[model samples]
Target: MSEPVKVREGAAGASDDKPGFDLGSGPGRLLVWLYGVFTVAAASRSVVQVILDFGRAPLAYVLSAVAAVVYAFITYSLVRGGETARKAALVCCAAELAGVLVVGTWTLVEPSAFPDATVWSDYGMGYLFIPVILPVTAMVWLRRSARR
Candidate 1:
């Protein structure tokens, strides 16, 4: 008889982790890598904005920090994929969608309000629309990992 395919469990019962390495499994590494990138990006942007010229556009600068916070949340949630993180990802991604849409429209119709920039400013035109893409991908990722 052929050997049965063993359903091995991971160290923490991480359902989606592949064999050989816990962290190197499937989208796990990708998620980790992306999160690290976003964390650095958002942190740096916020730091530069606040330190260099917080007075220039207080509203936009503060929103940049908030955007960074949301990105940070998304990154952490993706890396720490679990039942809770999945839900959090959904929420964060949804919020990102709202922010992008609202700010995109605002920047389009009422350009004067946004003297400074944010992740959602100009419909993410500044970031080559990556800001718009991240949340959608995050939602899909959460759904895929949800089946774990």
Candidate 2:
């Protein structure tokens, strides 16, 4: 008779040394997809505006570019799928939330301040508030993943 193969389980039933849940799986997958889409959307919009008429709304254009960078970094971190990446993504998500709040309030308080809208203008009202909501969701996911 052939011998039966036995599988070894590590601590907490994990078979490997990885310390956290996969950041790119389950709901994280949706977050990654959303971030990726935002990155592309914000990047393209900023690039076109900066190239065509940056003087028209320099602050708005710059902020859009900043949003794009933040989105890209979060997406990368989520896809990386490790403890370090989870921490980094958490920090970035916090920053992103702060930026959205600050810019959203600024735009509301002083409409003239931004002749055009950035990705985060009005808490991402233009983009259906996804900009504001995404960071919070990502932060929660990252934190939860850390405990796994």
Candidate 3:
């Protein structure tokens, strides 16, 4: 006689038996770590710039703050590891990509508009383009993780 495994309840009355997928495992772990790093980096940069010289490049500093928020949200969603979290991460990733593209283009088109470069400027040229590449990779991973 074998006993049945107990299934725990998750957030919003969802079953823990099938928690969508583990976003904190395997490559997703790397994504989470990278996002966490970016969150800290962007946040720190923006805060210092805003405090020291916000008037010098208000657009750039504000955009960096926005990037930090987005990065933090994605990091949280990845660690949460649920269907709702996955969807939210995917949407944020798309928005991140769009931000990168728009900011990169804007920086190139109007150099004077940004007295200082944002995290997304030149497609993250200052960061070796990781800012642009990360979101695409994350979206793919999030989509695949949902199938697991």
Candidate 4:
């Protein structure tokens, strides 16, 4: 098998000849953790929406379901690395950012548009702002790993 790349600070900082693999490599693994969280949140929200009141916020519920699927896809891409997957993940992240922004604005401007709540409703206020932070982090990481 081929050797793995050595990770250091600043992408060109001092290099250490430490052999073997470093668990710290590959997007710090916490990304996967966060993605897992999003998966659970989106999936659960969609399920509850469908069960409790699917007819109330059909569009919002559909968007939540879409978000859940996108989150799942991103998790898979991150876990299984490849150029295509990475690119697709980036696109998904970008789309997620757009979704949050648009939905947030709509909720603020037209509260009636969403009779109930979706993942992006109120900018994910119920989720303690993680929804706002996640997409930004994804974009940053994508920029950092753009070479890939």
Candidate 5:
């Protein structure tokens, strides 16, 4: 007689649901790393700008702070890696894209409006356009990961 296989109760593989959706796998790992880097860069830039001279360009400084916040949230949500977090990341990414386009255009149309450069200025020219590209990439990753 042969012994039968035994499945562990409450184990992730034993259940229909996946072992929790992790956004830090495969390609997503790169996304996560990039997001992390951006979070630090944006936050540090904004803090220094806001503290050093709030009057030079209030609008640009505030916008940079907002970008930092958005980046931090998206990075957190991605690392958290759950359905709710994924949805939050999706929403934030879309907002980030919109911010980039608006800021980029505004900087071009009215150079006087921004006395200083933001993360999204000139479509993220200061950061090699990574600010504009990161959100789009994150959105795609989030969508594909949801399906898998």
Candidate 6:
């Protein structure tokens, strides 16, 4: 007769050295996906705008590209899932929130300056405000993960 196999605690392919933070689980998963989507969308849009209409609205287009880069980095950090990555993401999210507020206000106050919309123009009205909301949510999630 053969004995039944038994699995040990923390031995089901799990590691005791596992990170305490997981920024890609549950709601964090959604945040990562949204950031990824924004990365692609902003990057592609900025590329085309810079290529064809750089003279028309250089500032707005450059901001779009910058937003894309930020989103990409945040997504990567969330997926990396560690204390260091979480801290990096937290800082980036704060910066992203500040950018959205500044750019949104700038667009509202100086409509003539923009002449075209960036991802964060008017508090991300063009993207249904996802650009504005994403960072705030990410910041909260990152903070929560750090506590875990």
Best by TM-score: 2
Cα lDDT for residue 2, candidate 1: 100
lDDT, residue 130, model 4: 73
lDDT per prediction? 0.73, 0.92, 0.94, 0.77, 0.87, 0.91
| Candidate 3 per-residue lDDT over residues 1-148, each given as its tens digit | 9999887545576565344658989999999999999999999999999999999999999999999999999999999888888889999999999999999999999999999999999999999999999999999999898777
List where candidate 6 sits over 4 angstroms from the true fold: 1-18
Which digits, one per residue and each the tens of the lDDT, describe model 6 over residues 73-122?
99999998877788889999999999999999999999999999999999
Show pairs that collide, candidate 4. none
Residues 1-148, model 4: lDDT tens digits? 9999887654554333321232224663777788888898899989888889888889888888888998888888777655556667789889888988899889999999988778888898878767778888876875566543
Error of 6 at 138 (Å): 0.6
Residue-level lDDT tens digits of model 5 in 41-105: 88898889889999899899889889989988988888778777888899999999999999999
Tell me how far the alpha carbon of residue 137 in candidate 4 is from the true structure, in angstroms, after superposition.
0.5
Q: Is candidate 2 or candidate 4 better by lDDT?
A: 2
- Candidate 1 vs 4: which has more lDDT: 4
Clash count for candidate 2 is 0
Question: How do the residues 1-148 of candidate 1 rate in per-residue lDDT, one tens digit apiece?
Answer: 9999887556575654332332224665675576567667767887898899988887777777788888788777666556666777789889987888898888889878878887679878988887788777767767766565
Q: TM per model?
A: 0.78, 0.90, 0.89, 0.78, 0.87, 0.88
lDDT of 2 by residue, 18-59 (tens): 645679899999999999999999999999999999999999
For candidate 3, what is the lDDT? 0.94
| Candidate 3 regions with alpha-carbon error over 4 angstroms | 1-18
Off by over 4 Å in 5: 1-20
Deviation from native of the Cα of residue 69 in model 1, angstroms: 0.7
When summed lDDT is taken over every stretch of 10 residues in candidate 2, the lowest stretch is 8-17
Best by lDDT: 3
Task: State each model's C-alpha RMSD to the native.
Answer: 4.3, 2.8, 3.3, 7.5, 3.1, 3.5
